[model samples]
Target chain A: MVTETDIEKLALLARVALSEQEKEKLRTDVEAILEYVSDIRKVSGGEERAVPSLVNVMREDGTPHEGGVHTETLLSLAPKREGQYVRVKKIL
Target chain B: MSINLSELTIATARRHLANGDFTAVELAQSYLAEIEKKNKNLNAYREVFDDVLEQAKGADKKLPNFRTSKLPNLCGIPIALKDVIMLAGKRAGACSKILEGYVSPYDATAVSKLKVAGAIFLGRTNMDEFAMGSSTENYAYGVTKNPFDESRVAGGSSGGSAAAVAGNMSLAALGSDTGGSVRQPASLCGVVGLKPTYGSVSRFGLMAMSSSLDVIGPFTKTVEDAELLFDAIKGKDPMDSTSVEVSSSKLQVKSLRIGIPTMIRETEGIDPDVRKNFEDCLKQFRDAGHTVKEIELPTMHYALPVYYVIMPAEVSTNLARFDGVKYGLHVSGKNLLEDYVQTRGTGFGMEARRRILLGTYVLSSGYYDAYYAQAVRVRAKIEQELRDVFAGVDCIATPTSPTPAFKIGEKADDPLQMYLADIFTVVANIAGIPAISIPSGTAMREGKQLPLGLQLMAAHGREDVLFEAGKEFEKLRDNRGGV
Candidate 1:
């Protein structure tokens, strides 16, 4: 069973803040979902089968690339923009 | 003759435009009028494009030289796109606040292809936030009501696209199906929805939900229109390396063996009306001289549980991109870490947050092997079982959804119950196979008729079989005078 502490740790790891009420609700919801999916442990056994279609896809290292047409468009979408760059909070 | 937009299919509309019977601008205007009348109650389209007539006017000029100019099949067709798809310079938010005011930088490969085909996009439709929930209720904007019955949900996360096509606001619409996002809503809204085989269509522009399971498909009023849209959009794309080129052969209905999962019907939660409709569909298949056999798929019971584990894990990882600095909702906090917390916590809806938390819990240190790894192994088992079953049968049939469209707040409180709404449709995604949900009949509920869909699953890369079966099933339904 997941406790409030576990929920808190998960919220921290997930980088999402939860209120006391939301955290308590998540604790119950997550616990119920985990208990339900625990059936996977009972059914899954032996060696894992290889999924054939999941092959490593690679592109040539030195292909000429077209410049993105939407640099201005993308920059305009940023919440806080300064000229051509997106502005963010100071870190250090 | 004045055209009734409500009766227009992509196929019929194309012929009318080709023959100069109507201009694309007129066609678009008809749909715009319909959207104006119905969008208030249905909540299908998030934004109707202001330049729809301008785009249609371009198509009208191009329609005259089609034969010599090598115009595409979808030329001059007006269509709707689910909000999750990116169209350069347009807002593609997946119905979430985090992505509010965010404009796409480039066209999704599918969108680019549709544009190249001279298809006029009418607008972007609403959907569940990040395509996370079974109903469109998870939307930060508003829930899309079923066009047939306003009180019930249009099955989601492509609910808006389904509603748009069902309400005749657009000829056809593009929808991305991750765990039945396309098919369930299509079923609920009484339209045709196809989820092509994994990697069949490029996902370069679609907002990632569960990357492994997300396949962009179409919602149309007819199977033939779905085929046209699928053909126009499907191909290998360099931007999406997972896409592969697969050749298809014609499917012969006379020689087809349709497998019915007897065990699935015996499973709980299926409504009696849905079962009867399914049985009626089978009887129609039999009357049409096709064989239906009961097949046991024991792993079917475990699909929902496996999906819940695997999908949320992928969702958690995929959604990490919305950190708020670059393109979406950005909130300032004391520090960088707190910035992410506040932005996401405030931006995401309850369903999205719950899934993110569940995903984080499963992928966390101690529980990775217990939940995530185990779920993968079982997923492989399910895939293998489906492969073995396909060797013996041409296609497998099941109810697209357990019941008709449920009331809006019916399953809202219980997340688990809401997840169960996709129970019958997720198996195709998990196994990387093609599935189509076509309207079989309608069931009566609360003095109103709600649509029920029959789902058909085919082997990987065999969407041809699905289309063939779907076309035949549609014919049988029409013969019986059933919508």
Candidate 2:
């Protein structure tokens, strides 16, 4: 079962904030979800044998440039942005 | 002049449009009327463009002068697009309420190419929310019904595109295939569907489902139409890094070696009628002077688990953009975090939520190496297996779906059962190869005629072979006078 601590960590890792109520609810929801995936854990060594396609597909070595969706488009959707970068809530 | 342009093939419509037999406006109206008449029964369209007539007027004026002898293939053709593909100023919601009322400001690269080629856009078709389901029943707008029988599903998440073509609401439509989304529906609806090789078509403005597997192709009544549309839309697009330059070739039969994977035939839960139809397809090919062989690609057995794990992990990452703060549906909360939690919780439907949660869980730090990493490794193995098999065979054939279209809601609750719908189709996606589904025959279940699809897969950049094989099959079917 997911605990309050687990919810807090997950939310933090995902870069989203959560409240006490959400934490409580997600604890239960996430716990039930984990129960659903428990079958995967039970399958004999399925975790060790899996693989994905697109192996070693490396990006071309060139000047790092952001392509598609200009800064105007990106800034258009941001809650706030300093000249060019997204402005997030102050943590300090 | 009163002809339904949607009912005209890409070639026929061009002929009529050039001869001044009918104006584009009249052609557009005929299709609008047909859509009006059939949409309530088929659910093939989500939103019909209000300015289609205006666009058609513009197209009529822009018809190029190549001496008027023969016109461009797609000129004045009304084509429907799956809801996932963006058409500027049109809503491309992918059948989800979360994106309701969202209009694309820019057209997708393929849509833009089609527009340049003088193809008339009918409107956006319906699809499973986020292109997630096999049956279009998961669509938020409503389920798309089979044109043959309203009680059955049209197959999904390209159901609307397939249904529009099959029901004669449109002659050809663009649909994206991720796992069997495009092919399954085309088979069920008894139309031709093509999924080109990965990087064959640009994915520049499509909403992401599983990025690696998604490819935009066409659903049409004929192989010629599929080729015409695919040729026009496919090429290198700078916007998509994966886009490749593919040279179109004609199907040649010096000596074609066709592989029928016995492993898929022996897969659990294959319906008897589908098996018989698949066997008949093998026999037909043999009789047609092509060499047919049974090949073993045992790695195909693990496609589902690998796909499920890898796709959700990708889903977890891709769906992070829909947190309600930036441009989608938002539910107010006291703070930013509360707002995000509530918005995602309520805006996403049951299936979406399940996938997101599962994806999130699998991609979590500690579990990433175990689930996500391992799945990627296995994916490479599967790709190699495909390469090994293709070394001996010109193409592989299988039943598109183990069974024909089932009733809506039959497999909705069973995710595993719903997943099996893609068993025959996913290996192509996993291997990043080109595949097509052509209607082989029809099966009778409970006094109803249901369509069955035969799948043909070719090596990367080998689409001509598929079209050649499909052409012979199409000719044979035509001579049989339609099942």
Candidate 3:
């Protein structure tokens, strides 16, 4: 039931360029994979009993502490940093 | 007898350390030498701490009390840590170019606990970038090869840790399990990998990946070794809100009900040998006086879809901090968004980008409710099913993987195929249950020997069951002693 367009969209979303041959290979392979997942769908009902382990994990209110991150560590991850914060390209 | 010192479990190591059989300095140096020799081919480590000898030397002086059995269980053992864990003033990049050259100012809580336990910090093992892939192939450093066969993957995002243990480069290593990142690779590499119940181990120091599912565990050579490592590092931490202080029942294995999933046998692509070995294990359990029963967990089928949606959604949120303006590899551009995209596009490897994109899409405004929200509901259903199953069963058993280790690049070309590597292992994560992989038998790959593992999963907070069952199985396997 999967189409080339569907695969193409997925690829674009995933940012992997696929050639004609690659797409062809994926058509069969992905279909099989999807079929496997679809079988999983059967094992877990579509929506009836679907529930997650993490539920409303709320925390008590507390006074905010100053972020303990070393400025050097924070700035180090940035391509560029200003005095107090990371510098980014001007969007406006 | 000298070599025996290195092979000793943490428990035995502590005993010897107390008796002055060896100093911590000697233990650290021996492991360092072994790692240097074996790691050249395995590519298991990203960085070996230069201060290990100094740390060991200090420990040697304080060994008096530790030798007296009054100290923590890990006083003299050398435990390797995965690179994703924060270590004070040490590089802790989760094996990604984005976080290259980054060092943490503070130690991860687990690392701090292990340090306080008098454990030696060996080094950081490699991992999939941001803990994304099934094989260490996704690591920017390079793929970690299986210890048994260099041509095959060690199974990942904890591949490096598993390899370090299997290759005997470290006595024990810490690994994180989001979706079998620890257990699957442990299975493939023929080592013991434990994924503790969610909140059993604090995650204050681990790099975030699907926070709902992530838990820190160990990769070791034996079940007792795993328990030794787990005992030292597991406890509730004030920093990690999710962690709880639930002490497990120290019950022995003789009085337990082992459950095997009847529905899992119906899963497609399971290798016949793995299936047979799992059955053999069940039979052994029966012979050992443990009752084994078949149970139904119908909600398990939706695990993959729920995983795809929820994991991606969480990944998208967790990875948002790696913008170009932050502390990793970044590219600059005229516009902020352009800079962000280019930095991520360039810094992240293919697998990371793939997962990030999938996450972004699933959590995108338009698709959030339909895909991500629905997946959360599905996850709850899966959890509910687990509660139902656990009410009747003490632990569940399955083959860790559909098959044993595959060739290095066999499934690397296809992401979906690679994702399936964690399929059997993922259910444990989704339900926040504890699981462990132990060596069962050997599988032949292109005429080379490969080890297959049988995984046992237990209800939340019941790691004791896994250790009990694993110990019995180990005894049985030792008795059999065959190819």
Candidate 4:
């Protein structure tokens, strides 16, 4: 029941480009998987948001480690870094 | 004198190091030599730590004081990481093209614990790219072939960790399981794997695949070795809010009640030899004075469907961090949106992209109620059912995987068939309970004897129940006199 437009929109939302061939193949594969997992729709409602084990785990905002301990190391992992910051394509 | 890895467990390794029978450097070298001999074809390791011998030398310095002083269980033991678990200053790519050469800035909590216990890092093993697929075929580098038969896949996404242990490249290893990533690979590779209770082990440095289901586990030659590694790495951490203080209850009783879900008989594509092996193993327990009975879990059939909905939703969210700018592969385009689109498109493998798109669709505005929300409610229902079942039985049992190691390219083309491989093991992850896979017996496939695994699941925080049952099963299996 899913349309090609749905597939293209999903790809856009997910921010993944697809070749025409890849789009066709992915559309087919996702259709089959969706059909299989659609069985989840069969079971009715329990309390919504009633995840039995989930608890709100909040902690005070504080420095768990000394500042600057990993600043350099983390920046160093950037695919494209200029001095202290990660470089990205210009939007404007 | 040669090192007999088959005879060495963590317990014996500690004794040998304390007595100076062989230095830690020597043990590390033996494993490195084995990796060098086998890795070319098996592709078990993505990268072996260059400083392994140096780490072993540090362990050697601590050996002299160990005779009189109490030493940690994992000291001087060489272990492998499943690449998804970060080791500070080493490359961990999760076998994905996107993060291929990205180095970890800090150690995973589990890795830090192993370091404190003085375990030597042998290497980072290969895995499914972003831990997406059941077969190692999704790896960007290459597939990790089964150590038993090179033509077959070493089950994944922790395939390399399992293969390294089974192939004798390391004594013990760590892998993260979100479904059957640890136990399924262990089943295929003929080793022991343990998936501890969700939140019992911190996921601080293990890359997120499915946040609700992800747990760090151990792959080892024996169940005892698995327990040794589990003990060292399991604890609450300040960095991870979801991490829990693991207090394994002392299992006081010997005669245990084990439940075999009757729905397994209806599991599609289950090999006959696997079924026979499972029945035979159940008979062993029955003969040994433990009660084995069939239990009906009506909701069991829904586990896989639920997993697909939840896992992809989490995957799309977690991997959103890997755009062009931050970590690894960057593809330039006219502007920002195109940059992200092209980078992710080229960076991810086919399976990753499929899951990502599927996840996006399910969580999309119109479809959210039908797929994602309903799946969460059903997940809670499934957990409640399991909790009720655990009231009567100490553990639930099943074949770790429905079949023996499949051919390398056998199920690669069809993603759904590949997901079926995880049918038996995913329930444990779904319920956030502890599960273990132990080598049961071998099945003949194409005239080769491929090993199978028997899985045991216990209630949450009851890994002790699994370990006790696992050890007993191992003893019974060894004493079967080759029936």
- Give the number of the best model, judged by lDDT: 4
**Residue B250, model 4: Cα distance from true site in angstroms:** 1.5
How displaced is residue B132 in candidate 3, in Å? 1.3
**Considering summed lDDT, which 10 consecutive residues are worst modelled in model 2 chain B?**
B64-73
What ranking of all candidate models by DockQ puts the best one first?
A: 4, 1, 3, 2
DockQ of each: 0.74, 0.18, 0.33, 0.79
Residue B445 C-alpha lDDT in model 4: 79
Candidates ranked, most accurate by TM-score first: 4, 1, 3, 2
TM-score of each: 0.97, 0.87, 0.90, 0.98
TM-score of chain B of each: 0.98, 0.96, 0.97, 0.98
Candidate 2's error at B381, in angstroms?
1.4
Candidate 4 lDDT tens digits, A1-92: 66788889999999998898888888888999999999978886575676455677888888788988888988877888888888887778
Report the error of model 1 at residue B144, Å.
0.8
**CA-only RMSD, every prediction:** 1.5, 4.4, 3.3, 1.4
Question: TM-score of candidate 1 restricted to chain B?
Answer: 0.98
| Model 2 misplaced regions, further than 4 Å | A1-92, B1-7, B64-73
What is the docking quality class of candidate 1? medium
Q: Over 4 Å off in model 4, which ranges?
A: A45-52
